[model samples]
Target: MRPGHDFIGVGVGAMVFDDDGRVFLARRGAAARNEAGLWEFPGGMVSFGETLAAAVVREFDEEYGMAVEVGALLGVSDHILPDEGQHWVSPSFAARWIGGTPAIREPGKCTAIGWFRVGALPEQLTQASRDTLTAYRKKGPA
Candidate 1:
């Protein structure tokens, strides 16, 4: 229940890991609706009637041109962008890369995509992404 936002939104995020242990991240484009220019794990709002795992799969495909095998749930976070008038409950999950190279499929939404080690992630990260990464790391490598 934040200002400028309508209903409470449910979202899903995936911490996609490559075989080499690098995690995929994307830089939000300037034209992104919220948290523009911040690095984040590729994800999006969950559509009505969609399962959280399904949302994670669809989000990876839509944002990174890749498919993911959704793994265990990492954690959940309250992503309240008060400045942008958005409130979201985001469930983050661990996933394994299944196919396709990361790409900037949505130029208006993401400016860049890359894989990084936990110790070497970009400085500017979206709050939700930061939270998810921390939770993932605390759980240790699977």
Candidate 2:
């Protein structure tokens, strides 16, 4: 098997639902490299040697200043954006908040964070993130 042929980078996103079932989301900063100024699930690319679960937890803390107890794997999506020279295979997961509140932990990547009802997401969500949310809605939280 050719290694790099299917070696798309990995990413981890969290569907952090609150007591009332609202989900956490973040608006990408205007200075981000891709999909700037768009709402998206708070996450980032997994490091070269990182596990998907670990990456999810790390990203949650880094981006949102909160610790997450990751649960079931929600699903995976293979997204390719040739226009932006991006290709990633994202493994999303259902997570529960363990501690801390949403804060701008990583100012370079995220500008704002908020909780919204899953049924009523922001209109400016990133396409890939929106697709993930759609799948989550269809499957319901695990």
Candidate 3:
């Protein structure tokens, strides 16, 4: 049974910034689980018993080939993609890229990857990413 389809799922992500203060983002590809073609703060589903922070770290390592220093929680978002028939309760955090340059480690899940100043993000964004950005803006100066 699919986690988001069969029941509410838990996903985790991080807004990882480089020394230059640009956040990393990835465009979803055709094989993305949902919101294909939209850009998002890269992340993925949480494994059973994994801490949210650990999940965020693991996702960055596995999906972007980068290590991150997890910061405080950015916010929680209900990623209810009704049209796609998926629901996820996601907790996104603030993180700093500590090691390795970012790269698209999961080509099937991501079509493009880049770092951008928060103010100049791409127009099309995934629901969770939009929410994450909102929370980040509200936090301010961090």
Candidate 4:
């Protein structure tokens, strides 16, 4: 794949929910590939031959320093960063925090991590991230 531009990178995001029904979010660092400095879920591009669920679980641990129980596929949306010339097909999941506290392991790509109630999400969010959360909300808290 070409990566950015015309390539549709396959991505996976973990909507890690705590017992209180709040979801984890990470602030994208200024040095991120696209849509930098925006709030988004912890995830990355899915590698070739990897399943979406496996990818989400792996990415959550890699980005947030925690393992998660990857649950249902909440939604899918296109992340088209026109100004940055990038595109991605992102599949977002409803995951449960299994272990470890959320931490920004990769400082270059992420700056902070925190849990937020569904109704109190950050205003500046990646379009795909926003869409995913909206989809999750439509289903209501379980």
Clashes in each model (backbone N, CA, C under 3 Å)?
A: 0, 0, 0, 0
Scored by lDDT, model 1 comes in at 0.87
* TM-score between model 2 and native: 0.87
Q: Candidate 4, residues 8-43: lDDT per residue as tens digits?
A: 788888788888888899898977878888999778
Model 3 lDDT vs. the true structure? Answer: 0.91
Ranking of predictions according to lDDT = 3, 1, 4, 2
Give candidate 1 regions above 4 Å deviation: 1-4
In model 2, pairs of residues that clash are none
TM-score of each: 0.93, 0.87, 0.97, 0.93
Worst 10 residues of 1 by lDDT: 1-10
Worst 10 residues of 2 by lDDT: 1-10
Question: What is every candidate's alpha-carbon RMSD to the true fold?
Answer: 2.1, 3.3, 0.8, 1.3
Off by over 4 Å in 2: 1-7
- Screening candidate 1 with a backbone cut-off below 3 angstroms (N, C-alpha, C), the clashing residue pairs are none
| Cα shift from native, residue 83, model 3 (Å) | 0.5
Each prediction's whole-model lDDT (CA) = 0.87, 0.78, 0.91, 0.84
